[model samples]
Target: MNLINKKVTHKRFGMGSIVKQNDSIVEINFATDNKKFVYPDVFGEHLELHDASIAHSLHQIIQEKVLEQKEEEMKKEEEIKLQRKYQELRLGHEKLMRNHKLHPESQMVFWCDAEEQNSSLSEWKIFSGEIKSGNNKGKPNKPIRLHQNSAVLLTAVEPGRPEEDRRILGVYMVKDGFIGKLCEDGYIPAHSEYRLQLTEQESDQMLFWNYYVNEKFPQKQTWNTGKYRYFDNSWMAQILRDIVALKNDTREQEQAQQFFDHHCKMNQLIEQDLPKPNGSLMRA
Candidate 1:
């Protein structure tokens, strides 16, 4: 790395020997007079080193710098692209809200098994709750209220905790025109189009009781003995907004917002009409 006393040739100075080298600065004694130049920068264009080994090392360093610069530029470009897409999605959602054409019905919250959900989340990417009664008993239960574009919030009682300690596990949009099919013990998709699974830490932060406590039965959880129930769009909207706030990374936030906007547009609601992130939903 030291270039003291090394012979080098310059386009203007004719011939020179490095006299002092300090960090990036190099002073050389030339036939005409003393000259100073930035070390590797001069070597890149205006000068050439007499030592081949040192020249090779400088070449490698220059290559590395070029590569790093390119990578940083690419990263910036990607971030800009993501921002533009996020803005476009927001604009589209706002336009839909103004028109009132985005009506989504049949939204519900279902009780999901933690173990089965964990597996499906990683592998099948499907969900189903069992139907215990009626003509379709022993099959995967799809509520009559569920439809395409409907949002579903999945919940499970926290492991090692009482039923009162139930937590939300995931949120999903039922796939348009999807027919029920079996996956393990239940059905496919609930007919899902978009799905977002909460990490274990995230699940812990969102308790089911905190969001949907029964007012009449204050001591009871929202669903005491049901597979699922029709959920209000207003409540769902508020939950989606909170999910967006839960993300710390910019891309993650964008993704959450994307899902929020999709759900809002499908459900014929605007962000302003709903409660703010983490705000309580009003019950009638």
Candidate 2:
């Protein structure tokens, strides 16, 4: 038997050991480290097994690794699916663009990381370098310090609520992680105003301090941050997401309106000078 490096769990031996090996079946000595038991016929020959102190620990590491692998695989699969979906969506929009009757200014929404790999539109340009996803990292995929307005621009806005609708429509990507919907398309108005919701609790007090510290506010932490109770990351994340949405909505709308005004003025000037169909006397 060639099961020298095979790691195994022993009820009696505890953890550690390598397969000394034998002819009939297989013999595994589990008395390498605090463990003391011999297992046979479990792991086959030609396998390498290591010793573990806690039987569960060895299993735990294996399980964790397995879960990690599974998560990575799932992420890759999702990326593939997302790529396909966006491609299909892009083709659909291209088809729509070909139809003269279809208005091109419809606004829509979609999500993005700092990377443009998953953009819904062809024009999407995501942020690069450490701000996006890093080549190497302290924290995994850490987002860089973001400007309030720029952050809003990076935020995705879809035809419907992202929570309810999986497929957002009509948004286009521009340079530097900037994306917005066209007027004729399903676009969300971008704004950058936010409202804070806090309560008088200990944990809330801590959060207040966290926010203040983050904002460089020298304000003292109140009893709220100390006593505040929150369910978990999800609840608070939702609030943050909402605030970001509101802020972006305000900013984009203002910008969109400005464009409208400029366009309207230019159109009016052109129409005034252009020859009228009648060309007779159709002045107001």
How big is the RMSD of model 2?
A: 23.3
**In candidate 1, how many clashes are counted?**
3
- Model 1 spans > 4 angstroms off: 1-105, 123-131, 134-136, 179-193, 276-284
Q: Write the per-residue lDDT of candidate 1 for residues 215-278, one digit (tens) a residue.
A: 5665555456766666567778777788888877897778779888987886778888775433
- lDDT by residue (51-156, candidate 2, tens digit) is 3344335345546666998999999999999999999977765654444231122121124433332342334322232222455443222122211112112222
Q: How far off is residue 227 in model 2, in Å? A: 48
What TM-score, computed on C-alpha atoms, does each candidate reach? 0.52, 0.26
Quantify all predictions' global Cα lDDT against the true fold.
0.69, 0.32
- TM-score attained by model 1: 0.52
Q: What is candidate 1's local distance difference test score?
A: 0.69
